[model samples]
Target: MNHPIAQRVPGRRPAAARRPGRRPAPRPAARRLAPLALLCALASLATGCGIRATSVPVDAGAAPSRVGCVLPEDRERPDGDGADSIVRLYLVCGSRVSPVEREVRMPDGRSATERLPVARELLEELQRQPGAMEDTAGFETAVPNDLKVSGSRDGDPDEALRLNRSLDALPPFALAQLVCTLADTAAADADEGVVLGGPADDEAAGPLRRYECDTALRTHPEAAETAGTDV
Candidate 1:
């Protein structure tokens, strides 16, 4: 027996259905993981380990140094005691020589002929420890307590000052302090600086040397020993 054919409907779409045994295609593994990878990269950029990233070079000057070169008080002059006079003593601060005011019983004279007395007094003041205020302000004296000063010998220059210790034996800063302090006082020629000699009795006493407390010495006290001129 023959079967009859079904007739088609004009301008009408047929209904679609999925096969029972088939499944839809799965998404690509790379496409699904791409968003997660991008998120991780962004997080790493935002939170660096410690330092920040910069394309431009930055300049921060030299590292900070010890001891601020500041004076603690406004004591430029001494109290009006009849016996005491105000004087400047060069002290080491921040590895440089700085002037500090002090009061001492000036040894009764100011003439060039009486330079030794003034020199001795000044040397003693340098050897003395810095006062409370001076110490707090980073002022320190390198001159030794045992160091002695005397008038120049017979053949020595009239303006020369003698030291018990050889000039080479003293520390550079100590030499610098002495030179700078004396240069500003009656003990030395203010323009020519100070002339120093070793002990009169020492066999190895070298020729007198003139040490200037110029801007160079004040700034770089370590060069004090080499900054002298043979007088």
Candidate 2:
């Protein structure tokens, strides 16, 4: 019995020499969420470090509407001589344009037929050399004293007035003065604008063209420079 007692097993490790059990693998959802958790942590760190993004205020709708500057209303004097009505005349003052009030004796009639005479008188006033007061105030007019206006039946729309010279012959500033003056008078008659043609005596002249006095033309006479030779 002692002889056959025991033969030690060769090439076998002891129980204490065996490897320890391994930990379980992480779940699929947890593995997928790791990157997301890392991103959230980075964002929080950035915020904590006081980093900020830039932003701009934007106007998301149509722009605000603009209203043009208007001339003062005319003053009415019913009993002050024959010159009882006051009208605004656009005149050049230094580098800018402005309205100058003038008293004109309007005829008793309130018909459109009276517009032509009133327009003529206004033109005369414009052509007259700036008065002492106007000269002192740095006001001036570009209209020529010899320039004349007449009525025409040229069949052009709203074109009832004819100039003494070709529209192209007049300087832009001069033309603006004439156009605005006539337009102001015609407006009183409910006319949209003053339609003007070249000299009535010139048979080769072109047909009439309509002109209006807008805020741009009144406040900025230099705007007429690009109106072309036909204006």
Candidate 3:
């Protein structure tokens, strides 16, 4: 389901969970941090995933190339100090199931936090999965062995998709599709758990909505020329 964060970047929480927005200003860390920095830089592009319109034709005029932004609402918990804990999951390009990990520290040494990573190839599979539809219940799996989703002292949805080592042998989209299937099933299960545990004991589907802002896709000369033309 599309949430507020889908508009901005991947692997991120929603915006309200982030520091207030600043003009697309240049921040100090904007540069020098190549490699992984590309994503982080892009993350600063917009507060949330901007907007999405219906998928008309592949020729859908005016549609932006990217959809979904990671929201900042859920961030790595600050250096403990009595703050809520934070956990991050990364989808690497082409590694095994074991993703790199990290800890952001907790106020009380009693608890522990963990970050997960995955391969980029895996994430690409997440993008390609046909589940882009409204309510698909099935799932897909890629490299299930090399990856690990071990829980923390207190579990916080610690899951990441990344690539580092292991299977240089890529699976057909079938593999990625499998991972998608499992994740989806897990998400639905989580939703059910939330409702069951909610104070009101009420079950509510998460809010989902969309908007269209970019005119470039539809405004492009080729798209314009095709508009109102015979299918």
Candidate 4:
């Protein structure tokens, strides 16, 4: 049956309808990793081609050591009674004069005039013969027994002691002994070396002279020849 609207031409068919083309299926996971595996193998081959392993030497010895130590022993002490009241006086030992320490009994009085008495006592002690111990030790005195010493009140700066005899007539050693002993006594009274003058009757004598106790005078009494003399 033919209808006007549904009629088809004899040589040509109706325009064919379009259809979508099919996409390929995904491959297995292991099969997809094959390219990466081949790349890693090539890298390993490149690195290992020329490289070699190496080794170094080491020392094996013993260490060092040390020594031991030691210690010391103990000692004893000495006595010190009656040391504070002692005073020193120069005495002749052999040809040389040296100081000897002895005990002094200070008076109950404390006035400045008390120094003269102390000095007189010291001079008396000096004139006395040395005791048995001192004699045995070769210590003696050169101070004359009769020579007297008196304090000066003449307002003279150069006179501390007045002697009973001419200073020039005394032996060098005797003068040295007297000078040193007086010097020490003067020091006890906080005074400098003592100044001495000849007998009061010697108005014509030279000026008073000052004297000191020193190491050189002790070692060589002859050195006193120029010391304590008027210039």
Candidate 5:
């Protein structure tokens, strides 16, 4: 017996037959764009930040350090070891002035401690180069070697010391060193700081200016010239 063929529906097409191993039809535009939208969103997020994307690590230099400004125990002499002969000189350390002790012969056999000799000795010590221990402890001298000190001129105060150079000629740090060193020593009058003047020339003598080594001066020696007091 012969089988009858199926009749075609009017206004409707027959569905295409799918072959084995064949890919299905492409999805709708909306569905196909979902993956692309996700990728675009990820790319936008990566670029949204102001910083640039980098895989390589950057090298920053070592961290900064501060000077301790301290001396070793052996470097500091004991008080029992002839404390009278010990002289304290202010040295520059970490942009400020600090004291360093030194021992010197105090003019043997002299019954009286004169201001001129003691002042000269201390000034010379201030100009001298720092020792190895001092160097390691960040101590340095700012006083110029050629700077000289002499007795006061006529009509000047008995306690005044005249320098070969004028106050303005000296660097701030150097002046601070001298002022602090002298003011802290016996060369200075009791509670009067130190009186200093320039050499007397044919034109005229430079006026005397008194300097004090206060806590502010020790903290900021760069402004030393402004710390002078009226004679």
Candidate 6:
């Protein structure tokens, strides 16, 4: 940020004054040369956009509560969409933005997407099953909990959502209701798709990779920028 100018002599004229002001009238050639100095100054120290180091003060209002399932984006996919909905849930969770397009083109030809905000539950679920946590976008929170872990301890948050969705395919929905009842022991307003993956310290390579990868991808883009460049 600091630019060094030639040391100014007290009695002598300053180096800057030696040249006429930037807008001085002169031979047409000199006027054309005027902007070149400023241009060179700009090219020397290159910075992309106005990126400054500061943990962005997260706008909590923009993010949904971790306590419950966020409402579905369209509520109606409009094309007899049912079977694959459950599997698609965990594909993206607990992310404010997706560097890739977070959209799906349904069989009916109309495409729909949602920018699901990342919550602790979503992160916890991803910790359990990183593969399942593909995009972490378009998740619809209709209930308080995504997965129902009534009597398991492996503590895979994201995978549990997939398992619970299987239970959602049950005959009468008794298991899901029971899971919700048990979760109410702690999360009183809990519902489906509200990710509640056991305690946070159960997995090692799951969500940790996501956080690390996301951080690195967002910060050190320069490394990848020139990755495939030809010498």
Candidate achieving the largest lDDT: 1
Off by over 4 Å in 3: 1-62, 72-85, 92-166, 170-231
Q: For each candidate, what TM-score against the reference?
A: 0.69, 0.57, 0.17, 0.57, 0.68, 0.16
After superposition, which runs of candidate 1 have C-alpha atoms over 4 Å from their true positions? 1-66, 74-77, 190-192
Task: Please report, in order, the local distance difference test score of every candidate based on alpha carbons.
Answer: 0.84, 0.66, 0.29, 0.66, 0.80, 0.31
Best by the TM-score measure: 1
Each candidate: RMSD to true structure? 9.7, 12.8, 36.6, 29.0, 8.7, 22.9
Candidate 3 per-residue lDDT over residues 147-223, each given as its tens digit: 32222122223232222221122342323222322232222123211100111111231111111112321123122
State how far residue 115 of model 1 sits from its true place (Å): 0.4
**What's the true lDDT of residue 182 in model 1?**
89
Off by over 4 Å in 5: 1-59, 74-84, 107-113, 202-205
Give me the displacement of residue 56 in model 3, in angstroms. Answer: 17
**Clashes in predicted model 1:** 0
TM-score winner between candidates 1 and 3: 1
TM-score attained by model 5: 0.68
What is candidate 3's CA lDDT for residue 100?
18
Candidate 4 differs from the real structure by a C-alpha RMSD in angstroms, to one decimal, of 29.0
lDDT per residue, candidate 5, 1-231, as tens digits? 887976778866655543558797889999989998877778877675344558897787877866767889865573535535766789999989998888775544322257778788888988999998888889998899999998887887778888888887888999999888887565687774888888755235457888888989999998887888768
Model 2 weakest lDDT span, ten residues long: 66-75
Please give the lDDT score for candidate 6: 0.31
Error of 1 at 103 (Å): 1.3
How good is model 2 by TM-score? 0.57
- Candidate 4 residues 31-134, lDDT tens each? 98898677766776878434453365445465553211111123121222453345567788876787766666544343456656767777887887876556
